[model samples]
Target: MATIQSQHKWRFFRSGGFDQVALDSAADLQHLSELDPKLWTVLNCPTTGLEFDCRTLALLDLDGDGQIRVPEILAAVRWSCERVLDAEIMFKAPGLPLSAIDDQDAEGANLKAAALRVLEITGKTEADPLQVTDLADMTLLFSPHHFNGDGVVMAELTSDTELAQLITEIIQTQGGQLDRSGGLGIHGDSLNAFYQQAAAVVDWHAAADPADPLFCPLGDKTVEAVAAFEAVKAKVDDFFVRCQLAAFDNRAAEALNPAVAVYDVLSNKAISSSDKDVAALPLAAIAAGQSLPLGEGINPAWASAMSQFKLLVVDPLVGSKSKSKAGHLTADQWQQICDQLEPWRSWQAAKPDTTLHQLELERLQAIVAGDGKERLEALIAQDLAASTFADNVDAVERLVRYQRDLVTLLRNFVSLSDFYQRKHKAIFQIGTLYLDQRSCELVLKVSDMARHATMAPFSGCYLVYCTCERQGETPLQIVAALTAGDVDELMVPGRNGVFYDSQGRDWRAMVTKVVAQPVSIGQAFWSPYKRVAAFIETQLQKFAASRDKDIEAKTTTGVTAAATPASTPAATAAVAGFDIAKFAGIFAALGLAVGAIGTALAAMIAGLFSLVWWQIPLVMAAVLLLISGPSMLMAFLTLRRRNLGPLLDANGWAVNTRAKINVPFGAALTGLARLPAGAKRSVADPFAEKKRPWGSLLILLLVAVAAAVFWWFKLN
Candidate 1:
């Protein structure tokens, strides 16, 4: 997402996530907007009333009741103890639930402080939820390769000069005999050519001489040859026709195979095509995920489980000292961690399955080495060997079962791990994105160029994604582009991109260019969190229900499953010592905080009315159109690009469920309005960038008073 940062810049700097409710902490006249510096000064703001839950960030009224305040201008004046450094992190991953990181800074400018920052910047806003479905989970997302393999060479290879010198010395001492035997095997193009020649010799077979000159060359009959050619042509036509008919017969045979029934089961209408979403694309599961077929990496059970939990991320968890706006974790540390996990996978692959005997089935797993890999390699080294023709022509009865079993096991391990790694890469962002729920499928599907990989500061590409961790009706795709500065371009979907869905389908996306700008890490991880959270919530609910049933069964009939998560408690605390009065006071204080600002706003309104004339509808239709016509047009264009009609259709489970996710301004604003409140539960504040000016707003208020005074004097 290096290129997706533009929207973040445009959002924080220009649009400022503006909304009406959070703008006027000190209540302003309705229908008016502005960035009031005074609003920044007083703690009391009626419009951006503080909510206890803190997910809702209040909107800052920067321009005295007309325009939103610029974040930079606010930061320049008074420090609002909100922004994390100067960057916006809270807005990126508000629900990350990172408590340890938050305690680092009291002023809340540290990386963890960003959650509060996003709110302080936005102030607060009241909103009617948009007429959209499943938007609460609107967050950024993407999949990148994160499950890294260990280094091949633990120690660096010797340099050419060192190798050459050693080789020369060896040759001088042993007259090159050592070099011929051990220094280097027959290799390079020369070795390849030798093998080719040997293979050619082994495969060479002389065809019987069809000409038969030994018996009949003296005949030399041209007229007879022409007649023979005509006969051959007729025979060739008949053969061609027979071959076509055979092709048709073969097709029929394949269709009738049991394999065809298996394919039908795989594509059964009962499974993916459910009544909940009949209009969804028949290939929705394909759209959800794609990797090697089953029997490659994991068992069918594991594959199905994984399909439910794949992800696609673009950046790495380890932050390099590269030119990135978001300060990421140390790359070397993350690499070390990546190295540590290698043995776990290797151990799983090298499970001693084949070694155990059937007699030990109750006590042990088999770990037998089938056909040794070394044996296969030895055969492959022979000149006569081609994978296509490695046949035991003498019918020596090769042990095919052992070799196949190991190969099959290795393949299954590789495919599942690779797919899981891809999924982890897509959604498991490093900075934030705490485990909203621990046990659910997180599938990541991304499409890139065929068999292509790109190197980053590390050996391979790493992708980090952040999304708005909100609830939604459907799954979404989030991406983030990293850069050193504020970006302004919008990033859209591109070709061979990855997407993860709710039902465990992770598929690569087929798209063209996705124009995007840099997005902060916080903005990238929100969607996955939302999905995981939803799944976890559901799981918890289901678990609770099951527990109730189990308890009932145990009490009534004394029957239960052998497995159990239920456990007895050691002790219980008495509730008699609880202080109700103190808790009530705390609640009262919270209520006062919300209402205090409204009073101040009422006073300000009274004062303003003493100076103003009347509601002349001076903001006439023409003037209103002039002020917002272009903006309205832009909004309209954005709606069309978002394609909510198609989205709504999909949500409705009507026809054509291939809906698009276009992050619209309204949707963003809604996310923004809820930002401050959302930040309270997450790791850090995401929106508090630079604070608005207190003096600027006070100055304006004083100036307005002076103007009203002057008007009264002139009338007198």
Candidate 2:
């Protein structure tokens, strides 16, 4: 890959500890494709979650894969530069001028024509340079009723009432697609699907002609007859099966019929004919070779259903034919009714499954038989004819955006000079987080804290992940880099702050997590001493609490003893008495402890006095180094190695450069608080504590002890 080269001469600048090619002119961007991909700061970046214009990013992301890669950027740059006559005009201006468009090439000419058409439609024919906002006003270019080459025809596209109502019915039944004009309409696929379902429904209804005895069974009344048949079919079949079983074995009849105990249970409570247990009994008494008595001997629970069945089904097939008695249906007659309705059952089962069935059959037939489908097809074709115009308008939009945003993107992607020079916030920097008495500008939007934290530790910079929220909006997480301030107050997880986005929208932010690293060398220098002080304070608090508990227990014991009736003066005196021997022993131990500490102090003071003043300073310096040296050195190494790559990579960018944020650069990213210039200061305070002489007396005593030690050393 190194052997491969471009003829273009590239100029480079040093930043982030690496060389980045300069994209300062149109020629540089025109030749960007020939440049080495290895030198680009970012190979690709997500089209979302950035401070840059997302609309422009979407235009650059040709594949629509949510990432804008080097090839896509190169293609966009090449296309935009070619369409312009003087590519240098892109950097100098914010909009694309009509005269600047190169009309020599066919593509460029088409784009210019489209731009003119857009201007004509918008009444901006005199607009020298077409702005991005002009193209964004879609209402001016296409109305809800106009065809904009999206292949969708809205109901208002036709003035014919029948056609419009047909389109509305198609949309209501089929759930139409939304068109570019913001109206719900149908494209070819949806329109074809709707009519096809309509045709199927018509064919299904036609197959059930009332004149066909095979399907309708009872001319003009088949549906009602079939419904009645279904209602009583199961009970009638059960009754016949029980009769067949009784003929097979006589004893089965007595067992299959309702037992006397069932009536005994019903006798204990008020019962209705429609009661569930009563309906649950056999439809009629089971008997061998018995015709089902439809009228008088029938189970009261099933009487209503049997009447409808007799009128609709049994009467039509058997009573009308005079083949059976009026009151009963034999087993053979029931079989004949089931056999005659089978064709209709099969026909009904084949009905189409679609929401189009909601339309009346006649309406469906009229729609299928009319020219609505052909008209819709023609309308879609007409809409599709404007596709080229629509695409050209988009090209105009892209041209305008590229003229405005191409150079900025090149700076952020190819070089990152904007970030390094501190002239602009990088695209990945979402907003500034004001926290811990400091304003951190290098804040990035975070989607998932757990996922970000996994790779963020490698950045070697102190980061705080906060959940920011506003009322009536969703909560989002952001990670802010704390580079300049002391970390003493920043490591608290529940700390609150305010974040201002690039648009100046304020959100309440609360720190939910802290990824600790060296914020600054000064903070590291005091960390060890602070830890020691904290440990001492914690121990003192524990000791005080224990002592208080012990004293309280003793006081309670004394009060109890005083209230006791059996407590004598002798007992009280024994408890209160202190042994003189024990007192004397404790005093001796205290004296020995004091003597040992004083001896150690005297030795240190005499040794210091014996040394020369210069040597004493050196000794003190060495002691300080022993305490704070390792911490500062470690902090320095970490601060130097802080790279912005991992932070961006965790957010879905393929950052190709190290993008180091060394100590000085890091400090610029985070701004510590300071008073305004010329601010006044005063020493007097009404709430200040009273003046004290103990500090001065302690200093005087220390000087006197040093003088006495020097005198004694001279005498020796």
**How many clashes show up per model?**
149, 0
The candidate maximizing TM-score is: 2
Task: Name every residue pair that clashes in candidate 2.
Answer: none
lDDT (Cα, tens digit) per residue for candidate 1, span 333-363: 3233235333333333443332112223321
RMSD vs true structure, all candidates: 39.1, 3.4
lDDT of 2 by residue, 4-50 (tens): 47888899989888898878887887788888888889988888888
- Which lDDT values do the candidates have, in the order given? 0.28, 0.87
In candidate 1, clashing pairs total 149
What value does the lDDT take at residue 95 in candidate 2?
Answer: 73
* C-alpha TM-scores of all predictions: 0.17, 0.89
The TM-score measured for candidate 2 stands at 0.89
- In model 2, where is the ten-residue run with the lowest total lDDT? 320-329
Identify the runs in model 1 with alpha carbons over 4 angstroms from their true place.
1-612, 616-625, 641-716
